[model samples]
Target chain A: MSLIQFFNVTKQYPPNITALDDVSVKIDKGEFVFLVGPSGAGKTTFIRLLFREEVPNRGQIIIGGRSISRLKRKEVPLLRRNIGIVFQDFRLLPDRTVFENVAFALRVVETHPREIKPRVEKALAQVGLSNRARMFPHQLSGGEQQRAAIARAIVNNPGILVADEPTGNLDPATSGDIMKLLEEINRLGTTVIMATHAWDIVNSMRKRVIALQHGRLVRDDREGGYGYEA
Target chain B: MKLRTAGYFFRQAALSLWRNVWMSLAAAASVAISMFLLGAFLLLVFNVNHIANNLQSNVEIAAFLQVDVPRQVSLHIQDQVRALPGVTEVTLVPKEEGLQQLSQQFGSEQDLLAATGGVNPLPDYLRVRVADPQSIQSVAEAIKAIPGVEKVNYGQEVVERLFAVVRWLRWLGVGIIAMLGLGALSLIVLTIRLAVYSRRREINIMKYVGATDWFIRWPFFLEGLWLGLFGSGVAALAVYLGYRLVLNMVGPAAVFVPLIRDQGLLLWSTLGLVAGGSLVGALGSLFSIRRFLKV
Candidate 1:
């Protein structure tokens, strides 16, 4: 089933500059896709639009058969709760422990207090950081911090996980480990859309690649590699 | 919000208070000390005003009639005294009644007062109470201007000194207390502002975590409320104990002090101070959070 649809989407920043111009695409449920391009190619804008962080100028984006732009401002939090998001910099609260950080997502969405403990434990186990549950963010290495962030993002069992450069700051070995985890998560039926500039990783992944240039969709290929783009 | 949610927010407020213990203590202390001083000042002013009212009504003028004045003339003089401004009450003292009152005052010397025999020699007089002690002099002079009145006496110099001192003390007490109250209010606001500012990072994190703005804000609001209620409690206790100590210190010289004797008014006013303190603390916290800083 098509879980995400962008029909004739366009986004323009102020002063006559366009971020995403008439870009249209569709992704099936549980699909793992790669978004690739050089800087200013609307890769960030594309992910931001999917999360409804930035609205398109002229478009309709349907996620789970609901129009996003028409949603009221108060409903934005409800929308975001169902969609997990991971960042490049691993934005974790420094004061909270690993378990607290993972549990925070469910707690905020008003999950039952009795259910928070087991859910957080399961998320930490999924991230292979169960032993580090009591550690603060400053105590974790770069890769572990990203894993903890992933645990927080997926703790609510969201149907969609949108990652903006999840492996951008890690070493090559750590990046491979994080990609393997993402693949494992995708196999569990959560659609994953990742934007990255890592040519080697994209080449090895051989997933659906959507490439953009100057706010225009230049290529959408299945089993596509990084070499398909300029 | 559910009770569970409210419980969580209250826990968060307590955690934040503990996290910034020094700032919280400073803010609370400022509120307590300010309220204590204000309570003390209010109590002092109330007692002083009470004493001043007592002193003002104590002195009254007496207009005496000449020996040869007819009974009709003395009645006319009594009516004239009653019509004068500031005259509160006027009672006519007939010659015989005045002689009888003189004998009572003379006590063991009744023989000396009754030596005049049945032909009473005391002058008929109009005993007067002026509304204000300060206006006694003017009212006495106006009484002396009456046609049948021979002399007027209301203890001029003593009343003048007393009225002057009470008015000066009241003015000074108000001025000093007002300045101190303003200073304390500003200090409390600054301390609370610092407290809220240091927590802006936590607020920003809450916003990013898909928590509604109100859900994140409620904890901080509760923290402010808790601090205010606690600080006012402390101030009330301090003021209450301090007032007891003051009463003890002034007991020997209480005649001059004339502290308020009614215990009920004292307690109601103390409760008012506590209420006022809590409100100021709560409002200061709100102002600092909403206006001084934004997350």
Candidate 2:
């Protein structure tokens, strides 16, 4: 069964400006999907809609058979809890240490204190940042900071992880490393849907690729590479 | 069973509190100053109201008797005064008794009174009180018309003036305190907003991470509560201690009638201040979050 189904989704900002128009797609459970397009290709909007950050103007988004548009406002949080989100800017709390930043995800979900520590440590270890758990965000390198953010995103044991431009800030070497880490996370039974505009990573990986252009889904291909021609 | 959740809520509250210690302190201090000003103004209004009530209840129309008036005639006039309209009570004081009362009133100046040397110059009079304070003038006139009554000295003009002054004062105190309370609310709210803005990134992150709006809102609520709780506590202590110092200093001098005669009332007032402080803090935090910290 499909874990995520977007049915004719349309998102408009203002004055007839459409971000995502009548986009329909299905992502199966445990799938590794890459969302690729230019800067204004509605990739952020797609990720945001999955998390129910903003409601689509006209369409239904189904996750695990639950309809996003049909869900009440109060139910959005529970839906969000099952989905992990990482961002380009890292979004780490400046004051919190790496450990605390990861643990905050568990804390927000009211995870037991005893359960929180082990879960956070495991997430840190998964992201290869176990040793730097005590360091603040600013003290870490850009790659390390993104790792901490990934740890934070997955600490709550989300079934699906959505990363929006997670490698947008890192160098090519570091970006490849982050990509491997995400692939490892995907291998461990968590579905990974990453949004990026990087041609090299997407081309080299040749994963299931979904392409968007001018708010429309241009391509949905298996083992696809980057670029409009491909 | 719910202790774990409670623990998390408070733990988060404390963590965030310490994270922005300076802003928290400023928010707390602003609340404290607001609560203090409100409390002090409250104390003033209460004491003034108390004094005014005492003076008003004690106000009377005094009708002096002529020199060597017959006891039977004075008794008859007393009975007639009692029958007068709006007269609540009429108590007759003999010359000797009246003189004694005067001597007691001038407690420190008893030596000066003793220099009069048994002359018994004080006049016998009937003290008349009216049921309605506003009708004192008519009551005084009626008392003066009674046969064998020499002169009427109700201090009606003075008492009316005092009532007017006291009424004006009550309103003025209320107006000032109300304005000050609003000032405190706005100031604390502004400070809390600053605190909220400082944590805007944290809030955005929380929302993105699937935190319920309440989960995002609770720590801020707790922060505000702590600010109010601590602020009010400080204000109550300051005002109470300050009041005690003033009372102790001025009480011995006997320069004026004691304003706050009831010490127990201060305890109640302190409790009120604490409650108000908490309210202000919580409300300030709520307003700040609602206005500035969008979940």
Candidate 3:
């Protein structure tokens, strides 16, 4: 079944600038899709709409068959629980240790304290940071911080992981390693939608790609290369 | 939330307070100073008002009769004054008894009486105690209209002056207490705001982590509570100690003033200080966090 559906979605900001214009797309459960576009091409807007952070100016967004466009403020948190987000900045809380950072997501959901430790340990292990659980965010390398962020995002086993420029700040080798980790996560039947500007990474992945330009979906292809030319 | 879980927030708040000990100390010190001054002023006002009321109770109206009046008429005047509204008691002091009492009062100073003691020049009088000291003026005026009453003396000027002083002290006490409260509130707000500002990164991370608004706010709210409670508790202790010290220095003769006699009032004041401190801290945190937590 399709996990996410955006039908005729258009997001206009103020007088004249449109961030996403009549962009309709759909992704099945467990599908891995890359959203490829140049800067200012509304890729972030697409991810935000899924989280209901920014609602569409027109049309609808359905996640897991529920219309997210009309979800109340109280319901937003529940929707977010089903969708994990990773940012380029690696937004790990500096005050918390790596283990605590990952455990925080479950804490917010009021999971039993006894169950939190094992889940946190398992998530950290999956991210290969089980040994560095005691280390604070500032003590970690850039790639390690991003990995910690991913660990936090996935700890609750969210059905969908939306990553915006997850590899933007990493070297090509580190970026490739992060992509491999994401692919492994997708193999576990979790949908993955990554927004990025890296053409080489997209071509190498050989996954379905959706391209956006001027806020409109310009192209959608299976096993596609990055459509934007330098 | 269960009490045990709520306790976790308290623990977190306490740890944060300890981590920022210097700033916390500064905030607490400000609260203590303000509350102490305010509590002291309240103590003074309470005692002074008590003293004035006690003194006023002792004062009464004394109406002197005409020297040539018949003894029966003087008796009738006393009975009439006693029957008036708010008149509690009336004692008629005849010329001889009045002179004897005057002599006894000045007996230690023989020179005070040597020149004046031939035939007892003081007139006979009816001393009247009223149910209400505040009705002295009206009572005195009523006595003056009685036939054969030569003069009425109720010490109205002295009573008015004493009441004026009490009124001034009351207003001054209120003004000082209000200023102290405002100062404490502003200090708490600023302190909590600073603490929030320092943790902005943590707040930003929490926002994107899908944490609910309440989850993000609980820690800071708890932090404010800790600061307020500790600060006010210290202030109350200081006020209590200061009261004891002042009582000892002034001695038991000050009982007429009753500076610390009403232990219940002091206890309530202490509780009020602590509650006020906690409330101020909570309010400050709430105000500071509102801007950051908006979706």
Candidate 4:
């Protein structure tokens, strides 16, 4: 079985709004994939289902040999622990320093105090944010804040990294820098899946791209380009 | 959980509590206000009950004898009264002594009695004490049925009225305390709910980062605990000081009417209030945070 599989999945909201309809896909370990679509294209729903944030309405989702479509409420956290999530707004705690923000991920899981510092330092270094550890989120630039958020996500060394428009708030140059960091993390054998509307980055990386249109999977390309215009 | 984990929760709780200092204070103040009222009512109830018990225990049935009843008959009646069920003791007051006591109550009005031709219209009576105040009416009725007894009086109207007042006061105290307690509980819940709502974005981030539900809960729980502790602590102090002040201010004037002055009782009651405050605060916080955890 593939590492992450969605078999004939359908998700619907109230009053007849179908987010993902009868979609089936498989993603293996150590594979970088991009989820490409316009707004309301079910890309966010797909990511939500991957993390068990929302369960499918009519199918099975398997992650790491476990069927998560009907996973227990208590076990949802366990599933999420193996996955790292990034958002467009860079959801770092405003009151905490960058180092504290990264360490927060470990602290919640009751990691020892002695190990929190070094692991946070290493994650910050991975994002090239070693010197900005003492700064707060507001004190950092837009790119730096995203970098801090990325550092927090990867600090747990999760097997899967999912980013939803991580570069949506940054300039083109900074977006490229963020993409390079994600690629480096992927090269380290962590499966990276990013959702984006950045055509240039999509065409340049040429990684696996899965396109969704109106809740249906339209194409799965091993080396896809920005087939649609911005 | 590790000590380090506990320390982390405590630090986080402290930080958030400081961040929302105004809201936290408001919740704590509500708890304090409710607890203070509760403590005051409790003290009132305890003291009133104590005074009532004292008065009831001292109730004595006075069985007045028939006019011209022989002394031998009066002595026999006293013996019979002492033998009756629940009768603790009986003492006879001769007609001469009754007249003497009445004159003494008149207090230096000897000339008035002299003007009445030296005639004493007083009757001999038996003072009857019972084991239980609750049985005073029944015992009085029994004594009235005895031969040679003209009437039985235990100050029936006065005693009944006093007991009614005590009962009413007790019920009123309970009702007021209950209403205040509910008000405090909801206020704390509302304040904590607002606190939770304000921090919901932070909570969502925590959830996305794989933090367990309990992990997100601990800090908030600790915050509630502190609010309860501080609020109730202040309330307990206020109640204690207020009681002490009242006692000192009214102690000498209320010498004839017994008031509760046991330091140990006051201390225990204040401590109980503090405990209740803390529990309410903690449970309120936990309840308020439940829906927000769905994220």
TM for every model, in the order presented, reads 0.69, 0.76, 0.78, 0.83
Docking class of 1: acceptable
- lDDT tens readout by residue for model 2, A12-116: 998888999999999999999999999898998998889887789998999999898888777888998888889999999988899999988887777778898
Better of 2 and 4 by TM-score: 4
Interface RMSD of each: 2.8, 1.5, 1.9, 1.2
**lDDT rank order:** 4, 3, 2, 1
DockQ (C-alpha based) per candidate is: 0.26, 0.47, 0.37, 0.56
Cα DockQ of the candidate 1 complex: 0.26
Q: How close is candidate 2 to the true structure, as a TM-score?
A: 0.76
Q: What does candidate 3 score on TM?
A: 0.78
Local accuracy of candidate 4 as per-residue lDDT tens digits, B1-295: 7787788888978887888888788888988999998898888878877877678778789999997889999999999899889999999999988877777787754664686677667778999999988888888899999989998888677778778887898899889888987887887778777778878877887788777898889988888888888999999999999999988988778867788889999989999999999998899889889988875
Per-residue lDDT tens digits of candidate 1, residues B1-295? Answer: 8888888888978887887888777777766777777777777767766766677678768788898898898898888889999888999989878776777888734685557664667789988998877688789889888877888887666656665766786787678767755555565566556656676655544544566766766776677666666766788788788888888898989888778767787688678867776676666666666752222
Model 3 misplaced stretches (Cα beyond 4 Å):
A1-76, A94-97, A128-141, A202-230, B2-11, B62-87, B90-128, B132-155, B255-260
**Residue pairs in clash, model 1:** none
Q: Model 4, residue A226: what's the lDDT? A: 66
lDDT of 3 by residue, B169-280 (tens): 8898888878877777777777777877877777765666677777778888888877778888898898888887888888867855545567788788878878877887
Task: Please give, for residues A43-122, the per-residue lDDT of candidate 4 as tens digits.
Answer: 99999999888888899999999999767887888888889999999989998899989998988887888899999999
Residue pairs that clash (backbone atoms under 3 angstroms), model 4? none
Query: Candidate 4 at residue B47, lDDT?
Result: 84
Residue A176 lDDT (model 3) = 91
Model 4 chain A, poorest ten-residue lDDT window? A221-230
Badly placed stretches (over 4 Å) of model 2 are A14-16, A69-74, A93-97, A129-141, B1-27, B61-87, B90-157, B249-258, B291-295
